[model samples]
Target: MPHSLLWSLVLAVHIISIALWIGGIFYAVAILRPSLGLLDATQRTSIMLQTMSRFFKGLTHAIPTALISGWLLILHEGGFANAPWTVNAMQAFGIIMAGLFARLYFGPFQKVRRAIRPQASAFDSIRTQMLIIMALGFLAILSACLSHPFV
Candidate 1:
């Protein structure tokens, strides 16, 4: 829509970054977490902690790329007022999602990782939070799709 090579590249990068971050969450929720039931508590905790550590590492890059590129795209279209409601919704959801992730990383995530024998309650909370993030991610995707005039 911006009709520029830069815009297209930025858009691609933004989409890819978000896909990696949220897609990882989905995998953890749907595939990884579910399959871990057979393992003992220690094994599950160790595996999940390791998985989350790497995932969060990737998020450190993805979040910034997605946010910055999104802002650039917004500015390209003549700033906030000129951008569609869907874009605004996406931005709001993205920011909230990032904030939520940070909170969990520093709070429950850290708590469980440092525990000698982490409680099941901690992982349950994290799972709930992940579900919320996943739902928000879906909402953002829906907002983006609805941006299409034909939609």
Candidate 2:
């Protein structure tokens, strides 16, 4: 395949994966959480757990896709040695975001998943982690936009 075509495809995947992961978090935190409060405690917990299960499952795939595609995009531009400062910064931020997500998944998320009834505290922890990840994601996006050769 032509390099340009390959780069375009990879970039598209990277963007889509990012949108899915970040957009899901935004929807859950900004919309679903508040709306869910209308339900009774038991119903709320059940629904929230089910919703989060699906979201996290999707994230497990999306995060890796974003990371790998971003890495490939970076290589296509040039390896780390030759990449611009913005690319390097974006990569560092991406790594931090991924690490934060991993921690959230294994820590608070695991607790939430294992509970006979998901606890409010567990959800709170997940929310906190999500906020951090979202911030990092935004910063990474900014870095990408500023560093992009065509920008």
Candidate 3:
């Protein structure tokens, strides 16, 4: 394939992956969490733990794709310093997101996954992390929306 087509494919995958990841988080945090409060703590925690496990299983691809595609886009366009505000903002957002992913991948996410028995502490931790991740993800989305790459 031509270079432009190749880049387009990468970009397409990257954008879709981000949409899924960020959109899922928004839905969970903005919609699901509040609704979940109706249930008792045990049920809520159990369900959230299981739900997050599944969600992360599906979302495992999003971060990696974003990283790879963003890198390629950067190299193709040159580097962060040379890119427009939109690209630069996206790169910054991506870095923040990468850090969040690392924490999720290496930290509480593991413990939460292990809590198949619905531990409240585990659930609380997972909820807190999800909030943080959701906030950062929303910021990234907002940045992307507001930024004008050509400007």
Candidate 4:
């Protein structure tokens, strides 16, 4: 493929990934999280775990694509040291978001997965963690949107 095509593909993947990340967070926060409060622990926990697993899978695939495309954009535009403050800030924010994502994946997510396989009582804990991660993800996306790195 031509370089432009490759870059276009990367941009498409990045945009889609951001949408998935942001949309998943929005759904979880605005819908699933609230609805979960009404369900019994067993049902709520099980559902939450399942939903989270699916979201995480998408996130796992998306993050790398977003990072690579974002990095390429940065390099093609200008190296980090030469980029404008807004561009530099966007990259910095992305790194922070990535770190938070990693923590969510390796930390609370793993704990929830391990704690609540068969137990319904563990649903509360799962719900709590999910909300925390969802909020953080939402904030990160908001930051990226407001930053407007593409401009």
- On residues 1-151, what C-alpha lDDT tens digit does candidate 4 reach at each position? 9988887887787778777776776787578878888988778778888998998888888877777788887787667777766556656665666776777778767877887364544445544554665565566556566657565
Q: Write the per-residue lDDT of candidate 1 for residues 40-71, one digit (tens) a residue.
A: 98899889889988988888899889899989
Tens digits of per-residue lDDT for model 3, 89-135 = 77777778778767876687787666556467665666677678777
Residue runs of model 3 more than 4 Å from their true location after superposition: 40-42, 149-151
RMSD of each: 2.2, 1.4, 2.6, 3.4
Residue pairs with clashing backbones, model 3 = none
TM-scores for every candidate against the unseen true structure: 0.93, 0.93, 0.79, 0.76
* Model 1 error, position 38 (Å): 1.6
Comparison by TM-score, 2 against 4, better one: 2
Off by over 4 Å in 4: 1-5, 116-151
What's the lDDT for residue 85 in model 2? 89
lDDT of 2 by residue, 31-150 (tens): 999999899989888888889889988989999999999889877777868988888888898889889888988888888889888778888888888988888888988998998678
Residue clash pairs of candidate 4: none
Local accuracy by lDDT, each model: 0.90, 0.87, 0.76, 0.71
Which 10 consecutive residues of model 2 have the lowest summed lDDT?
72-81
Lowest lDDT sum, 10 consecutive residues, model 3, at 114-123
Candidate 1: segments with Cα more than 4 A from true spot: 1-3
**Model 1 lDDT-worst window of ten:** 1-10
Off by over 4 Å in 2: 149-151
